[model samples]
Target: MSKANTAQFFESVKAHGFVRRSAVYRWMWTNYDDLSELLKEARPSWIVIARELNGIGLRDARGRDLASDNIRRVWLRVSRDLEKERQAARAQQRPAEPATSAREEPKRFNPSRLPANYRPDVEIKPQPSVPATSGPYQVPASIDVSEVPEFYTRKDGTVVHRTQEQRERIAQQRAGFEKETRHIDRYILTQKAK
Candidate 1:
């Protein structure tokens, strides 16, 4: 074909599309933060994260949508990157591991570094039970009376004062609404600390 004809043909091909590996990687890096958040759930199935990545305009150079499989590969790479970063952070915070020795000597542990609720394996001595006061309000003996607030807002849009009836009602409400949790207690304590 003539040079002009060849040029015309190449132009049309360029206009149509040109998918490439470099382009996909470029797009992934451009949208790294968003992809990390979407994939942070760590769920085994990455179909959802891949779909979200595709939806956010990460595509082939030809402007075609990214495949779930392709996005999954990128997701795995990004997950590895995150893990590496996490490991690096932990390494910075912690002392380097000592070389293994023949002896099984105990390592020193800092009490300040322990988690807020972490308890050492030890027998807890039971306290002598205090006799319950003859009244409607039965606050836990563990809670100091001085720390109890005189007034607080309730979820039902009512403000309660430290009256005998209100105290009893508050105790009952607390018993009913306060559910025990495994992980959230630390978060709650953090919020209170702030």
Candidate 2:
């Protein structure tokens, strides 16, 4: 690439927000036509191209100089991109054809082919609410005793059992929480009534 081309490549790279590796790909794509002509004339090796790229201060994504393998990989990608562009251009140049009866019809979804267990029409019923517990502990009916663990771990890295005193303290806290929630619920109900 020439000095002006290098300047233009950097400018394009900044404008497109391309990464270091992608910037090289973009540069290759932009100069593909000229590069193709040069390739046809000189047929230079990948090692020569790598050397030229390094000479021009063009580096890979890692900011290291390009190797023969790196150049070969980038060249392959550029060639593929150019071929795709050519194919697209050719496609655009060709006239569109009308749909014919000879063309196969698109497949339709068959609901009957679904598994026997599939029940799309079935209505999802809401679960029945558990009755509120009236015991001194005043534990929420939603909580299952079987699910609660017997032992608990503290932040200080100590394993402790749910002692009678700990249980009483927990029950007291739950009672206070229930009282506050009840007050809030009553206030909300009064506001809704208004």
Candidate 3:
């Protein structure tokens, strides 16, 4: 059925309650006059006028009941587009056969028909290496003496010594020593001088 007639559309939906067919008819007629006037000054499209009325209804203090009306138009547009796409897909699927000979050709591969030593001629370039941003991996470079110990012990009574974190430990101990010395100096200076 053609939904182009707003009056008939409203009449068909008015029986759902909250809105009467007479009220819908009155609204359409009132908006029609406004739409005509709008078409003159700014030459606005009918769609624009209709959308404006919907926006006003949604924003007006006494128009809370019309909130769903704005959504109706948006939903209608979406549903119509979706329906068209679905119908097109269904129509395409209903076709039983292609109209061209290329659609009937079958691809076949016989691996045994080729020579036993047949090899495709291809120039293979080495893949470029990308440096990893994050992951567990080992570098091929020699380990620095400062990073690893010079020796390590194995379970077979093998003793190995490796580079130690002695510098870090020494620096930490020195900082603590300085802090304690400062506190002692402060206590001594703060005592009453006889």
For candidate 2, write residues 1-194 as lDDT tens digits.
Answer: 99999999999988866453465687888899898898899999989988988898888887988889878888888899789989999999998866765587877968889898887887899999767666534445465544667545567854445674498799999999999999999999999999
Tell me the spans in candidate 1 whose CA falls farther than 4 Å from its real position.
1-52, 99-194
Give candidate 3 misplaced runs (Cα > 4 Å).
1-95, 98-101, 113-194
Give the per-residue lDDT digits (tens) of candidate 3, residues 1-194: 67679878887777454343333333544355553465567875545645665665533234443434553454445446556968999988896556766767686767888899988789889997755523233222343324555544447743334333355578899999999999998888889553
Candidate 1 lDDT for residue 172:
86
Error of 3 at 90 (Å): 7.4
Q: Supply candidate 3's per-residue lDDT for 10.
A: 82
Candidates sorted on lDDT, descending: 2, 1, 3
Candidate 3 is scored at a TM of: 0.20
> Is candidate 1 or 2 superior in lDDT?
2
- Residue 145 miss distance in model 2 (angstroms): 99
Candidate 1: global Cα-lDDT? 0.67
Indicate the worst ten consecutive residues by lDDT in candidate 1: 15-24
